[model samples]
Target: MEPTRLNKYLVDAGVCSRREADRLMEEGRITVDGRRAVLGQKVTGNEKIFVDRKPVKKPESIERVYIAYHKPVGIICTSDPKAKDNIIEAVNYPDGRIFHIGRLDVASSGLILLTNDGDIVNAILRAEGQHEKEYIVKVDKDITDEMVTSLRNGVHIGDDRPTLPAKIMKMGARMFSITIVEGRNRQIRRMCEAVGLNVESLKRIRVMGIKLDDIPPGKWRFLTEQETSALKAALV
Candidate 1:
């Protein structure tokens, strides 16, 4: 409740981390009391603050929300309204402003989480790959046991380093379910490509312990009480 630094205030507002707050301040993107904020400036906890002209209100207690969206293929996982077919518009959520927790690529589809609660975002994403993300994928060609084992062992997907071990389950001739802790950009596709398989389609079915279950494509629902509690416990 005391006076807080601009960076800390931004973090509390669930906008960004203290370091990112400093960068935004330096970029002249943040304003306090109608003036561009300077580095290390402190807000009196009552002065008005804005980031890119959007007001920032740090609440002592904030209502938390979590959504399980069945993101459709070709929809982007970004808050930028300028983007074509962005998730926010696709979901048409009438609730207050919120952002997606993680991303599901434009070409890929399925369960993606969105929330207004910043603390949960920080807690879950701060650990990065510590959480689980499960996907069902279809490759262009038949998948062999060797390929599955190789994928589980780890593959150098043209990145600077190899990926960590992933859980693999063969579902069909060309279909497989894989779970990974880390989420590099287009990681699943890249991993398959490394082993000479081209991905035809991919769908993320789960994150943490939450699942898409029977949620139809393009529909989203608020996480249930038990689902939310389990997610928090998993993060712990």
Candidate 2:
């Protein structure tokens, strides 16, 4: 077989997405035939591969799984079994190993995607993909015109660059809905903080066209065939 990029190989094996595979390589958590894997390396599917010391199965052997989960507050979005309140334990998916597509802070809750298909994960999270994620946020004080303007115009959230302009609508005195294309660490909270607001509560309600509708907190459901088809079509 032709050699494959290590990242792509990992993605095909259901280990992680290409970006995550790169991070794992940088962190020295991936080994190729007992040697630390190098960024951008390629493998022929013959050499032994391990991620964090666990042997990785061949790509062809992986069975893809995808599901939408309504994460509740206090459930951490991590696969590490050692972490307290880890999402893996909370979901206890019976099929097989799966990882979250993105993250919601422990204090926040709502729609999250879990999957063993790293290709889809990579497509949805691609920086240029600009996939929309909608959230309902409640702040400590009343929403204001100035706050709306600043957020809609984009705010510097201590990152190298200011956040992209977001779609915002005031839903109530202390609540509003926001749609953003980028996913930064605690981005919505930090954006609010930048505009002199404090988030009292946050919940994601949608990703692209996937709605959190009727998925009670702490519950999940597999994506319908139509929903999955539409999502992949959008990515294409």
Candidate 3:
């Protein structure tokens, strides 16, 4: 068996992300063969490992799992409280605390991510970075050229700060597609409301490099291997 750093091994085992493993290492929360192990210490699988005094099982080399769900409107994004239309209940996924990479409001719907990898989840959702999310918005009134320009330039959405610059394209007389790198809560709705347009429907069509494609609302599918690799590459 090849020797590897304990922290790296722990991360690969899905015990924690690499950063969390490093933090635990610094806190002296790991041991190998009953000896306290340092952060960078190397070990082989034959040695016993414990995290927080509990033996760490040898993680099965199961393929990393990822899923994409086309959430329907009226479903909440949370798992707790067990609402009538919670995302978790809708999926009927097996018991595990899988989390969405980002959020969609209870009134909105579209592409949502479900993953077991904490590292991937953190990389995609970190708010300080730039990541474009595209949405198809239907408004109550016909959108004008000036409205499209205003959306692209940025507008005050009754927030303490102005909305970020965005890319907007006319889809129909009363519908448009908008892409914005910054995600604020109910941001698309608020921005449209600020410009005298009431959003009748909003659906996320893309997140960064991933598109919703033909996925139907209230349905989910496993990510193809290529899709998984592409997403991981985009994060880096």
Candidate 4:
């Protein structure tokens, strides 16, 4: 392999995006040939590289893969082989390694983006409020008007930070649909709890323009070019 930028190498390794790789390098967690790695340092993909003390190997070549998966409840969204029931195992893609773009709790299910394109992962996530994720949540009981108002108005969540006002619509006596731009861990559950509601179930159906559609739980398919383009456009 020819010499490659350190950040690009990290991205190709499925560890993180170029920007994040730069951050890691700056933090002194990355090294090349037993020395601390510097930003923009180049590697021939043959020299010893380590991230946080663990050896790093660049994949021979990575196929840019993007999939919209219908994650089932109980499947963890991690790359850990020991997880046993991780999203990667659930999808069982025979191609190269891919990582979840974001996360869904083990108890929740629905649409989750899986991809090997580290660039897209960083772009979408770092874009912050630029994209929206939609979910339908069912609470333990019917919600009260006051609770609805508070939830709609935004509430202090687990992080003790105020949530962004979300577009929420009541779908049934005990269910509602919410669209939020932030991807805080268990944000929906925390938001509901702040308003005195218990989340009985949570399932995401959309992220930006991509929809789960009729894809059965535990199954996945490659995104159409149009869908892929739409997703990339959101990053810009």
Give one digit per residue, the lDDT tens place, for model 2 in 27-140.
Answer: 898999999999989999999999878899998888787899999999999876668999988988886567898899999999999988988888777744278999999999
- Clash counts per candidate, in order, are 0, 0, 0, 0
Please, what is the whole-model Cα lDDT of each candidate in the order they appear?
0.85, 0.90, 0.79, 0.86
lDDT of 3 by residue, 114-145 (tens): 77676686677664348888999999999988
Error of 3 at 122 (Å): 0.8
Q: What is the lDDT of candidate 2?
A: 0.90
lDDT of 4: 0.86
> Mind sharing the TM-score for model 1?
0.88
Candidate 1 weakest ten by summed lDDT: 11-20
The candidate 3 region of ten consecutive residues with least summed lDDT is 56-65
Q: List the residue pairs that clash in candidate 3.
A: none
Task: Pick the lDDT winner.
Answer: 2
Query: How accurate locally is residue 209 in candidate 3, as Cα lDDT from 0 to 100?
Result: 70
Once superposed on the true structure, which residue ranges of model 4 sit more than 4 Å away at CA? 1-7, 13-42, 46-60
The candidate with the higher lDDT, 2 or 4, is: 2
